[model samples]
Target: MAEITTEDGVQIDLVSGERMKKLRSMEKIRLILDGVRDGNIVILEEGLSPDEESKLIEVTMTEISPDEFAGIEIESYPQQEPNPGFFSRLFGHNPPNKLTVIGPANRIETLHKDKNLIRALVT
Candidate 1:
């Protein structure tokens, strides 16, 4: 795992993932934002709720600059939502529970290219 220190000299581990499930939804969102802002790839094992996913994308998009880098890349492993209600079943629609990654395109690409690293951190 990579590490970085802030100006206040707080050392933070750069590699993180699903173990954060105990955090409240907005707290998790804050961590994601902080990681991305600091140019670190973030992984989420349990993934985000649909609303959180949308909000993440929206917030990240706004944070990007045309002059800085092209964009952020989001990747995910989609899982079926458990115990869909009758309406969801009847409508033949089940939104997925996604294992999401979000970060700068190049770094995110590097992380994706190394399956071993991904396995080590997320597993």
Candidate 2:
């Protein structure tokens, strides 16, 4: 697993695989954003295309509040967490405490701090 720090200074972990494929999908990015808002770290397995990565970084930096400081980490192949019980899984789903991303190193640090840019990318 790879680790990254967001502009907000929050630490994140990344895991790549079939499981993360769904999470990285375009439609699910919004859900990912929602999860991030709750302090859940994201995990991208197959990694994102340059464009996708750019969009994600753009969206994330812009969406985050100025008072917040989160960081993102990237991992090539990460371990999976154990499954929770039925009740917890059904009604108490929790996002991972660490966030992660698996992709190019260059684009990782190009955090754009414009809200309009982030809204355009995320929406």
Q: Tens digit of lDDT per residue, candidate 2, span 1-123?
A: 365766765545455444455554565456455545655455554445445555766776666554553533233222234876788668754433222332223224433434232111111
Runs with alpha carbons beyond 4 Å of true place in candidate 2: 1-25, 68-123
lDDT per residue for candidate 1 within 1-123, as digits (tens), equals 356556653343443444565677677667777766666666565577777777777777777787765456666666656687899889876464455666666454533434223332220
Q: Tell me each candidate's TM-score.
A: 0.58, 0.37
Candidate 2 lDDT trough over 10 residues, lowest sum:
114-123
Prediction 1 TM-score vs. true: 0.58
Residue 24 of model 1, lDDT score: 70
C-alpha lDDT of candidate 2 relative to the true structure: 0.46
Predicted model with the maximum lDDT: 1
Q: Lowest summed-lDDT stretch of 10 residues in model 1?
A: 114-123
lDDT score for residue 65 of model 2: 59
Question: Distance (Å) between predicted and true CA of 17, model 2?
Answer: 4.5
What lDDT does the true structure give each of the candidates?
A: 0.60, 0.46
